[model samples]
Target: MLRIAVPFTTLLIFSNCGMPPAECEPNSRRCEGDLLIGCDDTGHEAVTDCTALGATCVPQLTRCIVATPMLQPDAGQTIDAGEATDAGAEDAGAPLEDAGLPDAGPAVIDAGTPDAGLVCTGAFPTNTTAPAMPPYAGTAYIDADAMQATDPSSFVDLTYAGRGVRTMFDRRTNSYNQVNALLFDARFGISKHVEIQVNPEFTQAVAEQHARFYAHAVGQLPAFLFRDLDTMWIHDGNDLFGGANRNILIHVQQGRYLAMYGWLEEVLLHEATHTSLDSYHLNMPRWQQAATADRVAISDYARDNPMREDVSETVPVWFFSRFRAQRLDASMLTTIENTVPNRLRYLDCLGFDDAILP
Candidate 1:
């Protein structure tokens, strides 16, 4: 026999060459940079680069752990991932607390409903009709028959509890028909309380019946300018004058009253101011003297009664020409400012100068 001698160590290695590799427990894994080195189901070591699967290994879990992205709120805000529960000293799987990490409390969140009144939709209702007027028989000076004979449709009755006013149009001409538009403009243009409290009545018949007629009769002048005049007449419960009751009558006719003159809303606002001031008896003789001493008249009408008409005339001018900056004839503005510097000063004193332009 041929001599084939082998060492004992060589013989042992040769005997185990056909056997499989050592096996590991389930989920056994380790981290290597961005890779996951773990044991597969077959007990073979497998290499998986976590970066290839859009993940990174977290060293806290020891095994190949993947990191989860956290969402961020607004600037300077932080999100709480939640507090880690303590597993107690008896649990073997509990993670040790890191001494470098700060203690965190539970996050607080507000979840209350808001009040309904706080919401502003900016929706306002449209006003269609004027308030109704109270019943009143003509006084000794006012012919009840003629006043009653005036067309009902021509009158816009406005009433608010104890106070009431009837705004009648010119029965002779169709001009009064346009009073509705003027009223509509005035209603929205000024304060609701002021516009309603002023309670001005426009009636050519009433105006002519009283001594306070238009400067030029409706048919007497050109169709536009001199034809329409808004006359503010004082009335008692009965007569146009010499009455203790404080009431106002506005005499006007239709046809471009606002466009041609730029006066409708302004004039209404002016007269309403007058009605408001009249209650305080601010038009006393002393007040008149002081006004005359300080301010000059703006127009011939205002000149006729400076103390009385100054506020009315200048109010509209100040509101439209000055405050609102509405385009007006330069000459007119200059004339008003030059002639009635005192009136403007008076308005300033009364706080009327601080009008907020619409």
Candidate 2:
């Protein structure tokens, strides 16, 4: 019987070699002849036969480095698997540091202080509508007018009352507080199986406005991002958060942080990644490999919280560059390409079609 090898536990038997697999510390990689070997999170040997791919094994990196013909696809052309693989090799020369996580390697790249060219700034770019970088600005990438909810006026008559604890920012206290709050029965259905529950602290009018706006904005996003998201918790606080339990927490003040800022849709996308994409991709073997290969952090926030915030932080930027490139400026796009080429390519390779995207 022919057996297909799974990633993170691949066992490749070579007819010419009769050597036992060398044991190593978990998450550390090494080269064994033409084979790139690493210890997975479970301390099991994960082997990659580099010779088969016409690649060279490097002990410091996760992927076998290969030199392939680079293709420059026109703006209208779709990026193919071959392009993604070629792009991964662009930063192979950079040495990576293991951040002491199971599958995290910290990239030394800092956005604001790159060696040369346009330095990244906290100020939102004026040239395009790219979403504000998360944990940062609140500018809207997708215009408020663009994303009209399928049924903004749709309200489900389900009275859902529950006790929940979430981290909320208090403008008065000037800090985030873990508030044991009440989720009142008032709710609105924005999409199929999706509802937004507003806190009882706000008046009926305020709650309704908030619910309608949220429903319209969130409803426009690709459905796949909220697959596990059935309930959203809204309050009159000053921030937003995403929970592993498949929910998003919202605070009104985050949208009002600045007079020109407060693009909740952008923030919603960032938080949604935590709810939907983190579990599936966070510690996935391919994600780790891509991170190591890219060997650069998209932002300081991502670099600081490699395992926790990397996916959530990176996804908004990835989404903009891939699906909304027309809305982005040339310099900013160049920054993304220079900073996280491999990660961008990895996302491209995923081949998310209309089924997952809108």
Candidate 3:
């Protein structure tokens, strides 16, 4: 009887330089001195399961090969696979600290300093409808006349809820309008598996209208997995801001919620992803929750929470860029892969892979 050799645990191997058995049916054609690339995460090496533990084996010549690092850090960045994230246990939702640590509650950024409430702000380019998601009028149940104003300038007056006693930040032309679009798309995607609810606390009057649309869009999501969507766009007149338990509260500046809404839309999709994960599985640590969700770092929420943001950012990036036309830099791609080892799991949770983000 002849058999094909399986990969062995040890990198080095010693074997007689004899031709493979003619009846063995070699896996591939061979060369006199062909080099064998070690198996790693990028691809799999054909092998036979010799034992129940699924031990792999393969015949080798007299050479010991060093195990290559599974993940290689790019320049100026480091990849630490075993470095567990500092989250969930005591610091589940702790605020990010400036000194590479997390604060007890939340990080406070005085927003008004970023830009004038009416103009596009932040370091990234702004004022482009290309990134602007369409306003949610009929879809998310947004108020048509209000949230979807014809004159884009109407977005200038939208409210944001992130500011505390300190000053707030300004947003772009159609922040809230675009945000409504993102929320609608994400909600619909995740609603397939998990029951979901939305709570929009818009502090601005125009944003209040968008909140209404958001609530309306809730009904449009898959009825089976989604139980309901609840929104609170209007402030209860409360100024305090921090991470809340069981729900993700976005803090857009009052009067800038519209433009900020565009920014917040990505975050909303990310957070809402948590709800979907919870429905599919049991209670997991916040860090793992974000990891399984596969969010990326481009969004503000994901950037602040690197470990958790992995899934939240990944879904959007993959759906929008990889499967869709959107493109992400090499760094972003690396983050996505290292974050989630199982592509099937990530793609499975997000529903169909094509036409993911718009």
Candidate 4:
């Protein structure tokens, strides 16, 4: 994670609030809470409470800037920002199973509970049985039409970058391809920001649409999921990939494959896990120890590529099973519980907070 460092200056302050005022040089600019504090034309300190006028203190600007979009990262960049919320029923376009209520097959693990220790006493499996389908192949955990927090009505500015030729990986061909891409900074929500560079082989209308759609979808997820995700390269094809320098490659030809299965959002969730979690947890000794203790894999894909794809594959399954169990069928839930209880336990022990998640 990157830290924003603002230089501090010492100065005598007039007694008003007991708290000391934020220090500043004659022409220095910095943000102090909701106030934009800096030197005025006379080289004296001036304070403006940006929030009082429905604005925010952005250090880059001389004055408070008002916009529905979240405040941009201080000094043109930051690692994390924003709040989390559910993608309510308003946007859910997928069919949901209403089995009255979730069946009590296996005890559900509370996501918020802190792990006491690594306690996998269950018997290690000697043989592995393959799951029927990929976790995203069956039911849609993240509703395809789920209500987006993205306010299209709000102003969106393409701050920088321009038309240029860029190399983007095409997942369908499993190779890097050269294409003219429209590159720019797209900042939305309260603080969700990412660089969207799309293949301009598609029309400008289509490019902007893809950018907004993906931005909206990604915005619906918790901010923590993509702490490392910095850029999205949108191309044309049928596959998506994440990881390697914190990027997600998206193929916009989303018709037969993604729509037929309704795995668009779920697929993004998988890739996000790669960008945000793979480096920290995937190859860790504790994770390897947990795998050894459990000796089970949730899917054939995870089993085949244990080191590369296991965490990414299992996380979505764990996410739906633990957080959205009501939307899942009993048998599927049972499969998750039986197949990878130890994996679930390992995830639980990580102490991830589903903050603001409903």
lDDT of 4 by residue, 26-140 (tens): 4455677767665522344545566665566666543454543222211101112232222221211112222112234345544343333334343334325433333322122
Worst 10 residues of 1 by lDDT: 2-11
Distance (Å) between predicted and true CA of 147, model 4? 11
Per-model TM values vs. the true structure? 0.30, 0.49, 0.30, 0.57
In the range 65-166, model 1's lDDT, one tens digit per residue, is 223221111000011113323322122111222111111222111122222222112221221221121011110101111111111111122222232343
Off by over 4 Å in 1: 1-262, 279-290, 353-358
Which candidate, 1 or 2, would have the higher lDDT against the true structure? 2
Which pairs of residues clash in candidate 1, taking residues 3 or more apart in a chain or in different chains? 175-254
Error of 1 at 45 (Å): 99
Instruction: List lDDT for all candidates, in order.
Output: 0.29, 0.47, 0.27, 0.53
Total residue pair clashes for candidate 3: 50
Measured with C-alpha atoms, the lDDT of residue 3 in candidate 2 is 12
Regions more than 4 Å wrong, model 2 = 1-191, 258-262, 353-358
Which number leads on lDDT? Answer: 4
Ranking by TM-score: 4, 2, 1, 3
Candidate 4 least-lDDT 10 residues: 1-10
Model 1 residue 133 lDDT score: 18
